[model samples]
Target: MEREKVIEVRDLVKKFGAFTANDHLSFDVYRGEIFGFLGANGAGKTTAIRILCGLSRPTSGRVMVAGIDASRRPEEIKKRIGYMSQRFSLYEDLTVRENIELYGGIYGMRMKELIHRREAMLQRLSFTSYGDTLIRSLPLGLRQKLSFATAVFHDPEIVFLDEPTSGVDPVTRRQFWEMIYETASQGITVFVTTHYMDEAEYCDRITIMNEGKIVALDTPSVLRQQYGTATVEELFVKITRPQRTMV
Candidate 1:
């Protein structure tokens, strides 16, 4: 069966003066798949994501996200996707309910629908009592969870998560991935970037980038078999070792 592609990038390139961040990149992300975008620092992962999310325009090549041309319809693309950055974006001065309402309103969600969805999310996270709690008062793990829930509040077709579980404990990270799985099951494409190889394994498919190019892209099992490696971490180290050595 042919899966529907929700993101298509062909010969994509992004250059800042003399430096090329994404060099002739091309890929397709299927509908409802948990797609992992993996790369070492300075590998252009963030640049490419920014372009796809309509925060930045690609220098050249075709990029389509959620059926909108990213280069031409950047604002429209923004409406169809959600983004949760590495640093938490929730306002510490606001209560959980206030943060949710703020983002929901920004996404153009109505008051009635926003309230219904917000309550459901709070209940699902066992956070009904914390609705009025200021974000500054919550723990890091709890804050990260709320950030994710808020990002997807308006039912975007795709959500981009950059190091979504960076500083949390192992147990909290595990719980975070469960939420990711639940989101994918609901047919929301999960586009995540993580340094954790274990979390990479949780992705349905992964694309590894190095030196402004994709060095590997495949399912975890297939990528392991191709590299004759026992784990994704081993394969990642093997593939990116040369770049690490050069630096």
Candidate 2:
């Protein structure tokens, strides 16, 4: 079966004065995909992501996210997607339920529907007892899970996770990926950026960026085989840091 394209980019470019952050990039993200956007520091993947999220405008070329023209209608694009940053973008002083209500409102969900979904989400997270607990009181892993849940409160067509599992314990990270898989199984496109190579392997397909351009893009297993590397970590190092790779 032919997959539907949810995001389409062609010759996308974003420049900052004398420097170019994204350089003529082009890629397609399909519906229900777990697309990994990988890169080392200063690779311009962040810039590209911001553009795709409609948080920033691309300098040139076509960029469509969820069928909206990201460059021309950034605000409209925002309504169609969800974003969870590494910081877990939650109110430290707010109780878990309050924070969920806040984000649900921001996503334009109806009050009654928000309350219903919020309760269901808490139940699913095994967080029924933590509704009144302040976000600051919860552990990092729990807070991260809440952030993911709130980000998708409106059930967006796509979700952008920027290092969503960073700095968590291995078990917590595994649990987080399970949520990601469940989200994708429901046909929501998961666009994640992670530095952990093991997490990269969990993605259905990944595109590696270097120096503002894509250097490698494929399934983790295919990338490993094509690069003659046993692991995605080795493949990442080989592509992004050739100087550290030995012949």
Candidate 3:
């Protein structure tokens, strides 16, 4: 079966004063795929994502997210997408159930549906009793897990995750990816940006950004074979770094 294209960027560009942030970016993200967007600091990944998420305007080019033209209907696009970042975005004073209720309310879920989702999420995260615990009392990993659950409570078609696992332990990171896989399995397209090279392999397809432009875009396995590198990390280095000259 052919999957639908949920996002399309054609020659997208963004600038800050005189400095360009995203330079003629173009790509199509299919539904139900974990699309990894990789870049170092200042590589312009966030700038392009901001434009896609309708939080920032691009200087030029066409960009569509979730089948809506971002430049033309940013508000509609925003309504159908979810966003979570390293900051977690949870209200510290709110408990787990409260946090879910808050975002579910914003998404306009009904009272009955909201309760159902809250219960399901609490059970999934093993937070049945912790539902009443304040968000501030949770550890970073638990906070991030709740953040992920909250972001998807309304079941957005595309969820933009910006370094969602920045400082978590290895086990927590692994568990987070399992949640991402479960999301994708439900036909949600997950857009992830990360500094962790190994995590990129978990994505179905990856686009590597360097110096405000995409230097590589393909499956992790294909990129490894194409670059003759053994790992995603090595392929990334080959794409971003200057090749050594044979002596």
In terms of lDDT, which candidate is strongest? 1
lDDT of 3 by residue, 21-51 (tens): 9989999999989999998889998888889
> Local error of candidate 1 at 203, Å?
0.7
Q: Candidate 3: misplaced stretches above 4 Å?
A: 243-247
Q: In model 1, where do residues sit more than 4 Å from their true spots?
A: 242-247
Ranking by lDDT: 1, 2, 3
Global lDDT of each model?
Answer: 0.94, 0.92, 0.91
Q: Whole-model lDDT for model 2 versus the true structure?
A: 0.92
- As for candidate 2, its clashing pairs are none
Compute the lDDT of residue 50 as modeled in candidate 2: 88
Candidate 3, residue 3: Cα displacement in angstroms equals 3.0
* Model 3, C-alpha of 34: deviation from truth (Å): 0.3
Tens-digit lDDT string for candidate 2 (1-247): 8889999999999999989889889999999999999999888877888899998999999999999999899999999899997566799999999999998898878999999999999999999999999999999999999899888888999999998988899999999999999999999999999999999999999999999998988899999999999989999999988987876
Order candidates by TM-score, high to low.
Answer: 2, 1, 3
Give candidate 1's total backbone clashes: 0
Total clashing pairs for each candidate: 0, 0, 0
What residue runs in model 2 are displaced by over 4 Å at the alpha carbon? none
Error of 2 at 42 (Å): 1.7
